[model samples]
Target: MKIQQITKEVSIKRSVDSGTEEQRKTVQQIIRTVREQGDQALFDYTKQFDQVELTSLKVTQEEIDQAYENMKQEHIDIIKEAAANIRKFHEKQLRETWLYADQHGSVLGQKMTPLDSVGVYVPGGTAAYPSSVLMNVMPAKVAGVKRIAMVSPPGKTTSLPDGVLVAANEAGVKEIWKVGGSQAVAALAYGTETIRPVDKIVGPGNIYVALAKREVFGDIDIDMIAGPSEITILADETAIPRELAADLLSQAEHDMRASSVLVTTSQNIAEQTAIEVERQLADLPRYEIAKQSIENYGAIYVADNLFQALDVVNQLAPEHLEVMTKNPFEIVKHIRHAGAIFLGRYSSEPVGDYFAGPNHVLPTNGTARFSSPLSVDDFMKKSSIIAYSEEALQRNYEKIAAFARLEGLEAHARAVEARFK
Candidate 1:
């Protein structure tokens, strides 16, 4: 782990990842092929990338039942518990159609409508997190989306993770596809013979998946172009070094590109945390990955005071932020950015990642500055409503026409003036 003194706020900015040209070109070609060739292109790519020759693109009822049977009872219970939490949390975010009558006898309101269909992409390979399935799908379910389709790679083998399948089943995913990579994204965006096109796609994946989402954005809505996972700890002398180290490693093990940073006011705490992180890193099963992440992207910045430390945290706009200070509530008020905030020593990041009610699909790579976590709203769209009575139209017609004429468009002005006539 690296330790440095923060002279300025900008110095704490995490590394930004804009996809490489070659990666972009490869993803573009895959998207184009999937759009044109449809399921045939999916079969070819699955064989080429996943090395699996699939007889069918859809997961069967028998396979889903088998997935449920294969998982241990405890694991299934945990997934169900997490799903309940996710559902409860997202249900609160559900919106309703609202309208109001104005004094001038006009009605103005917004009609909240759920998307007809949605696609969720879950990353397969060695990284199989059932929590992600819950986070991405439950919101769409809560928003009243009628069809929720999921796509995940079968990996080198033809078997999908039992937990992922079980979680999907619990979340009411209507369709499940056994295709992945850019091809799956394209298939979801532009319907293949086997899979129907969805209105929006949401979830996290590798570089190819990210690029594919970027390519097919206009064709369908995407959650976000997520980058590597990251966490920032704003701690004081009150924070436990061992707990902080564990919190940092929790994200570091996600990927070698993952970032874990500590911004503290105490030099002693900083030194102890660095030592603790090294000790904890040696014990992780993904030690090599965590080590690489810690060595390259992890850092400890010593700030002059709590205010200065928060300044650093805001500038980073980390995906996850933990305030383990003596008075975390006071510190929280100063935090203007960050996708999620965990206050106090007990509120570790993983609690939110797995079982907590909040959606773990958060903004990454400084995107927290303007974006937000995946929620029910992402699965819904809204339309503004305008209904005017004869009198209301008469009252506003001249004003509208004048406004239109001021823009130098006679045709536009005439549209409103015609209503008067």
Candidate 2:
């Protein structure tokens, strides 16, 4: 890895794809087809893309039971533990309806209601992430969502991964479907005869799935147009070179487009960490993917001091940030943006990715600046309540009518006048 001296904080940010015109056009067609043809379009696209003929779109209870029987007991135990952690963390975020009566006897309150249903899209193929099933579904379950519908690509050999099915079952997802890619997203957004339309869709997927989410955004809620996974490490001479290198490669192996960056004040550690990354890269099974990622998007920035490195970290607003300095908490207090922060060397990114209760479905590709991780809050909606007494209405009627008149709305003024009359 090459080292660059930090000159401008803005220069540290990575580039993100908004989507190609061709991708947008194709996704639109998929959305339109699913909207028009429903279940037939889903079947055709599954055969066309996945090359798998499906008798049914929905996963049967028999399959779920078989998944539980086939998966290792230890793996099942771990999924249950992870689900518990996730549920515990999100449980704190739950809110209740509350009302307040003003001095004028006007009442104001907010009613929080969970979304009726949600569609969770888990990617399928070679990679199986039972973790994603837990991360996306558990939060919705904690928020009290009634129907948690899940969709994933049908495996060439099997309809869905046993681990994924087991995890979904553990997370309380009732409906699981063997559909994926843009077509699956389309089916979720618009209803196929078999698949009911959901209030929102939450999960990760390939570019086609992401683009499909972008196209159907207003029609249905989407988690985010997730870009490549990313991780940034702010370390010093005290930080472990091998551990830092290992952490960088962990995210790098996610995809060729994934980014792994290191910002440090120590020159010696920067060079050693770079060498360690190379050493560790050779041992990784996904060496080619990690190597390409490091060569293209990876970087080592030698900053003037810890403060300068902190400035660079905030500028990037990375999806995952690891502070491996001597006083991690002291440094963490200065961080303004990051989807998730791991303090000290022991708190690796994967802890949060798998075991930690906080969501692994984080804002990626610098969207952490404005967005947040998927939480129970994402699965709930709030409606404001206002009830004014006659006394309260009479007192404010003139001001309300005047304000409406200032906006050139005669109907609004008349309504208020009629109330007073």
Candidate 3:
């Protein structure tokens, strides 16, 4: 089979998608008004964006109870298991600040503190991913966040997705609001009459939600401005065509603009994988979405060698990357960028997204080169503690004064000089 031609050159700008621009601008306006007018603005936007009218902005306990009553027991059990696994994985990542004392009475240490509260934004755009609820909320719980609040746009008449409420209940959420979209983000970032503002906001949503997060970043912390979903498979002759095909199809179902690429050294393996993809697409329920995603951004490149495939992956820095080859370990070390690296065929992207101990809330669109997967660290802050004894201060006061004087800051020099003067 002939390998497909690569793009003339990598789109360094990565094609800034403008399809959602109109919605994004509308959302921004909603966020601004929501920030100024509070619950009234939320009520208005909920009607406009979500096509719902609501009496209350917060989901009542009675409503949550009813939501639980309506859901099937089997689904509840599955959510329970997923939450437990997610909590277990994040628990291992929790860390404590440390302190050290020198020979003198000076103490040097960092005090780790959790944010007072964090807001989780779950999109109610057509579906509810309980997995996302667990992934976003569990980390804050593990980090010891004092208050965890969630917001999701309710259906027309302000009704939340059942699974979202159930997942929040399972994850120990303190409050759940009947709001979604950019307006909800505004309410979280800037406190409303009923909803208290939080120190950080996280979770995924559509482009409107993404841009809203970007705008409100400084007012309150945000995890990341997520891009479209992506996956890249690095394979050679030893890989299974069918399994590779399944992996590619998995990410393709996320959105039409999502990218899925296969970089392989062996022409034979590349040909087989392509055939495998077509065969599997026939049975996929989300075939149109998967097909469009693959056709628009998908590709199979014939690398000169296995090393060449590795180089390509490093450059792309895909959100989900899989290495399926004779020695996956040898390839893993050279991978400089990628949100999550799945080694060997058994370690599929779905595994990490669901049950794996590592967080599925990862950096996307080449941001992995500098950013990282959501972790306990994101919810915690460090404050340095420094204490110098009188003897130590006397020893170093002149030096400190001299250094401050060199910088031409009399106040700084005076502060140090006063200690010994």
lDDT of 3 at 244: 91
Number of clashing residue pairs, candidate 1: 0
Please provide, for model 3 over 1-51, each residue's C-alpha lDDT reduced to its tens digit, 9 standing for 90 to 100.
125644443432243554376877776787879878999998888788678
Which runs of model 3 end up more than 4 angstroms from their true locations? 5-15, 18-25
lDDT of each: 0.91, 0.91, 0.85
State residue 184's C-alpha deviation in candidate 3, in Å: 0.3
CA RMSD of each candidate after superposition: 1.3, 1.3, 2.2
lDDT of 1 by residue, 81-116 (tens): 999999999999999999999888899999999999
Candidate 3 overall Cα lDDT vs. reference?
0.85
lDDT at residue 282 of model 1 (Cα atoms): 86
TM-score of each: 0.97, 0.97, 0.94
